[model samples]
Target chain A: NAGVTQTPKFRILKIGQSMTLQCTQDMNHNYMYWYRQDPGMGLKLIYYSVGAGITDKGEVPNGYNVSRSTTEDFPLRLELAAPSQTSVYFCASSYRAGGPDTQYFGPGTRLTVL
Target chain B: DQQVKQNSPSLSVQEGRISILNCDYTNSMFDYFLWYKKYPAEGPTFLISISSIKDKNEDGRFTVFLNKSAKHLSLHIVPSQPGDSAVYFCAATRVFDMRFGAGTRLTVKP
Candidate 1:
């Protein structure tokens, strides 16, 4: 099964340009998350969803937005891209929360804002 | 403030040697600790984990030790191989919140 899949592995955006990073998990996970990783930095959560139609902001959710319309898909939107938003984005999913279950991660999308 | 930290930015070990990667956390509420390894151009993958209730957990060549009193934990790899070269990240979770450390890059020489 494709645990998690992300579209547009790499992309370059101009200032104020908007785009969405698509993520899908065939594992039927109830919990989905969007995280960004800067060079020499740890993964920082931008947003997450408990299930379909439920979402919440995370530590670094300021420049990003997410929507969970279905259990298998969670997409992250960058409304106005900025240079600071250049980083590697990752999407992950877990069967449930607060358990021993590990969150499976996707390959990651490299974004550069010019 | 960083909740989890991996002070050493990089580590190098000779083949067949023991590699110990350290991690520390500032939160006392963290009940679960995990280690993840990532290669270039890929997302992090789970390596091993330990719960706060236990001090140590072992799996084959990898072992994780937790010290609740010091808010520290470590991952030890025995007989380290060149294939083990990668960036290792330490993570801690409490209920629904999880935090990760700035990974430590490990270079194993054959």
Candidate 2:
């Protein structure tokens, strides 16, 4: 069902540049999240949305922004990329939260900022 | 401060042996725990999960055991196969927030 899909599997950006990582889930999930994973580090949440038009910042939200314009899509924006922002980004979705439901993840997007 | 941790960075075992991966969490409020397996160039996938109320859950060759008092959980793979080799991540959830461990790389040699 293409549980979750992300565009531009790999990208390279210069400092101060901006770009959006596209994420879409066809599972009709109500919860969506964006997370980044650095080498030898656990996945850190950057942002998440409860539903369409609702979003909230997470642990590592300083350099990233997210918008949930629709239930199926949640996109992350890097306004001014920095070297520290370089990491593998993942998008995940679940039918709902606060239960035993599992989050389905999409193939990660590798980003490198110079 | 890392709330969840996988002390072992990597583990190796023969293809036919039992492989055990351990995880520990400092937060007692975490009510749910999960295990995910990830391969290179791919996102992590759900392997197994256990609710704090239960001490053990089994699915095929995979089994997850939880010890609330110790705040520790483990995943066991029996008769490991080469296909089981990958990075394993342990995750804990409290309400809406979920935290993951750094991950333990497992290699099953044939």
What is the alpha-carbon interface RMSD for each candidate?
A: 1.1, 1.1
| Tens digits of lDDT, candidate 1, B1-110 | 89999999999999999999999999998889999999998888988989899999999999999999999999999989999999999999875678999999999999
lDDT string, candidate 2, A2-109, tens digits? 889998899999999999999999999999999999999999889989999999988889988899989999999999999999999999998877456788999999
The positional error of residue A97 in candidate 1, measured at the CA in angstroms, is 1.3
Please list all clashing residue pairs in model 2, or write none if there are none. none
lDDT tens per residue, model 2, B48-79: 98999999999999999998989999999998
Give the per-residue Cα lDDT of candidate 2 at B83.
99
Provide the lowest-lDDT 10-residue window in model 1 chain A.
A94-103
DockQ, each predicted model: 0.72, 0.75
User: Which residue ranges in model 2 land beyond 4 Å of their true spot?
Assistant: none
Which docking category, incorrect, acceptable, medium or high, applies to candidate 2?
A: medium
Model 1, runs deviating above 4 Å: none
Which lDDT tens digits does candidate 1 get at residues A1-114?
988999889999999999999999999999999999999899998998999999998889998888999999999999999999999999999887754578899999999999
Best by DockQ: 2
